[model samples]
Target: MGSCASGTQVPKSTLRSGSRNPPFSTRPDLNLNTPWARSRSSWREEEPVTKPSRKLVGKCFCGAVRYEVADEFVYAANCHCSNCRRTTGSAFKPFAGIEREKFRLTTGDDRLLIFGEESGHDAHCGHCGSLLYSVVREGAYVHVAMGTLVDDPSIRPTAHIFVGSKAKWFTVTDDLPQYKGHVT
Candidate 1:
């Protein structure tokens, strides 16, 4: 008996008698069979999908130290610097950069040892003396030892850093970008 906002006269027959809810029209233009007409429960049943959380895990050689990173890496690089070579005992240190917040120590927090000053530190497992990661850029990034990773990050080293300090015995075979010093 009342008119809708569109100025169409809402016939009393359109509404169910004694019902407080709005009128349910039988108009063809309403298309009540469409997806928009389905109830919330019905809509969910039609499409059910869930995304799994992504986690990249790593551990020390002796498994004394374990850590995990969520989502994606910030960057990856093979550092040929003397410091990395000396610490890792390798020709080059393949490392991946991750945000500090996303990096978590799952265990062996007490057994973790830090070398160097607060400005820069190489974190390792005290028990097995396994180099885990280096806290660099004033603690803004964690340079994870790629060798320690148990899961693939799906990212490859973009460049070779500090090639000037690369060991003479080792030769870089890849065509990745090389930097004489650290990449800015």
Candidate 2:
């Protein structure tokens, strides 16, 4: 029995079938003893392996809207702007920025409602009024509400934006960088 690259043990039955070529078998015409073949095998063994990207799931409070992100976030931030606070009903909103192409509405897409201008809009679950994300930069990116995330993104807020409009009653105690206005 031999193991595959994924460490799965292959049954001996499969290997002895004689219908398929055995693992590590090169072209019959190519001399396995040649330097070229040895170099090819060594190169194959040294090839870098990569893990598949993780998929993150998120949903509204009422579960009326569910979505998935194919990969990790491009960036994360805490927005202290009044608009975010008003929409989220919180002092600050932590969001993860992801490319639009990576975000997919897995379920309840029809239940989503968009508010605000065409250039930027806040998406929420129409059934529960749960804020999901804010589409900005002409829809190139989505600012996903971290609170709505059902899975850990493995990324945390690194900065605070729009601090000038932050609530006076709240104080940011973290050492993260803060920008008076939006970070350009």
Candidate 3:
């Protein structure tokens, strides 16, 4: 009809009678005949996304005990005395003091196991015990055990030293700053 509109003959009842207008150029078809783009062909999907690697690593609880904390976390506490609730049975005792020269020992410091015979010395993991902390007898300091950090020591407690031997059924309504014993 007019030499079939000069080329790509738009005649099949005008391409099914203009199924609601289309036919604008050689490429302007993002609407790609809809239906979610005809079962997806190039809706852009190289599919990769995977970022989460701050390079933190921890062990113990069997693994013979390994450790690494290149940096981050200068404080993070919970304490609550009574010898930190009979040596961490819990009711407080988060700790994570850092800086005893950045703490290392990439694997079993000779099967690391200490446990205070006199004053304060914890440090566990003799093959799956896992405590890893306590050394403060003015030994410059070292008290990890913030649940054996490996990241999550984002930090929050700047104070709360002993709270008069705390644990009278655990209570601390949070306003921080509450030392009743040693804040030094």
TM-score of each: 0.73, 0.77, 0.33
Q: In candidate 2, what are the lDDT values of residues 43-144, reduced to their tens digit? A: 999999988889999999989899998657989999999999999999999999988888999999899898977668999899999999999999789999
Q: Write the per-residue lDDT of candidate 1 for residues 59-172, one digit (tens) a residue.
A: 998998999987578899999999999889999999999878889999998999999877689998999888899999988888999998999888889999999989999999
Q: For every model in order, what is the number of clashing pairs?
A: 0, 0, 0
TM-score rank order: 2, 1, 3
Looking at candidate 1, the ten consecutive residues that score lowest on lDDT are 20-29
User: Which candidate do you rate higher for lDDT, 2 or 3?
Assistant: 2
Best by TM-score: 2
TM-score of 3: 0.33
Q: Given candidate 2, what's the lDDT at residue 50?
A: 80
Query: Which of the two, 1 or 2, has more lDDT?
Result: 2
RMSD, candidate 1, Å: 7.7
lDDT per residue as tens, model 3, 20-68: 3324442233356777775564545645666753444666666788787
Query: Which run of 10 residues does model 3 get worst, by summed lDDT?
Result: 1-10
Ranking by lDDT: 2, 1, 3
